[model samples]
Target chain A: MIRHVILRVMAKMLIPLILLFALYVQFHGDYGPGGGFQAGVIFGAGIILFALIFGLEPAKAAFPPRVLEVLVAVGLMIYGGTGIAAIVKGGNFLGYGALSHDPVHGQHLGILLVELGVGITVASVMSTIFFHFGGRGRKDV
Target chain B: MIDLIHIFLFTFLAIIAIVVIRMRDLFAAVMLMGIFSLLSASLFTVMDAVDVAFTEASVGAGISTILMLATLSLTTSKESTLYQRPRPLALVVVVLTGAALVYATFDMPRYGDAAAPINHHVADYYIARTMDDTGVPNMVTAILASYRGYDTFGETTVIFTACVGVMLLLGGARTFYRWRRREDAGDPEPRP
Candidate 1:
């Protein structure tokens, strides 16, 4: 692998911008053309870029596999927990009407929370998969 | 016009697909697949599905390409020279499937026909009441996260399952457990 200083400097500059764009996509899905999936993938791509420019060990230090596994599970919980909340509130499974007093507010809150869950899971999983596949057969690993 | 753009995209897509098939080099095929994804993403955007387009472009052009490259690094960069003839049965099967798919397209509703079955279904209700029901301007988000929350949940589960499966197949589970055991013994952790 060619370790070019110019590539290193450019990656350092671009990483933060990429992550910020991902956040925008995450929260802006409600009013525009983005959502958890796109945001998550973008964020994962950013981290992957960081790993590519730097190395696998540094990337793992930044985001550990253990933490990623937990995050993957947590995202699913956030999604499932929302449905359970609705059921507890005397609504049907996955129904958001009972989430708040106003149906609209309930829907908004539910969507936001669920989308967040999806974003976290997707981002973590993609990164984790990268770690696994890339780390394989490496002398460092 | 949108129709013209769609025609251009599909034409490009067909050419890319043919090139990808003809190319024996795995690396070139992968690159062509990315181009194929880009064209399809453009078509999706033209059809007003910006969300899908964004996803297809990002995943197809970015992470997947990198991962495949990483795989090529681990394996041989060049495809092996196998001078095997094409199977007659496989070609016939592919041709029959293509014909069937083309025939099936005739039954599909025309692009964005308001009178289409899908447009007449729950889509109308969602569009009519999205603001009142969800207060979200993005109907796709409102529907995917709230109205069709169950389906999204299922999709999330599928992703989770796939992740877990990969972890198992890639020995992530073994290493993680071993690392934990080592940590219990107060041993220093080495870089993975």
Candidate 2:
């Protein structure tokens, strides 16, 4: 269908830009109008676009349910693990100052890890929501 | 000059909201809602809340619209002509609340006043301490990810729970096939 082809082309062009923007938002949070949460949503939007264009079945094929489920769990674990790491280092949970030899470096590392977790969980959950809604058999386009 | 642009944007946003609410076709209403969200995001940007604007633009205008459209595809496009009786008491109450809010705004600080109580109090501390403590220049990010980390965790959990509920309630392909097979067998029970 023309819609499919147009969507595919748009996905090819726009997704990369979105991903790059996510990185820009993630790394440049300290200076600009974006951060972990914004970056995560933008990244999720890119994946959602791909899913929308390719159909839910193909999207599922590309990102298996088990893979998405695991990523969701892993993201949570990573976020929690960072907090636990801080606690183990004689600080309270999510105490980034206790993360490494240098307090500032530790903060950077902690933020990065937590942001990665946020991005993963957000992207997975968004795609999962789309898949769930779009995968209904009797639904007409 | 900027004030004039802001006023124009505000007018545009108001029109979009009116159209969204007034539209009879559900699909058109939903699409108009997307426009409404985008206009809201623009309004946020003009209000100097860039981060909130970005989230609103992406989530409200983009993802939420797509989700609504998908759901719409599964349902009837035509609306029933049933009419509901208007509640004059409720209407009066809503109007009174709106008037009160508009009146209260007259006593508030002008837009972006650095000497405002909001800027001088808690916001000042967060803005000052955020850079030294979190090493991030963006105070919002520091506040969200570090100071308010628990709230973010709670939000993530909420998303996960919603996804789980969606999966459970919306039966998968196998269940759909089973239901279809039963329908083919001429059972009196209606199919989901």
True contacts kept of each: 0.89, 0.53
Docking category of candidate 2:
medium
**Per-residue lDDT of candidate 1, residues A1-141 (tens digit):** 329999999999999999999999999999999999899999999989988999888998998888998999999999999889988988888788888888778878889889999999999989999998998876567
User: A16-106 in candidate 2: lDDT tens per residue?
Assistant: 8998998888777767877766777787777777677766667677778768867766777777888899999988898878998888778
TM-score of each: 0.90, 0.87
Best-fitting candidate, scored by DockQ:
1
Identify the runs in model 1 with alpha carbons over 4 angstroms from their true place: B86-93, B173-192
Model 1: lDDT to the true structure: 0.89
lDDT for model 2 comes to 0.78
- The regions of model 2 sitting more than 4 angstroms off are A1-5, A139-141, B171-192
lDDT, residue A30, candidate 2: 64
**All candidates: DockQ:** 0.84, 0.60
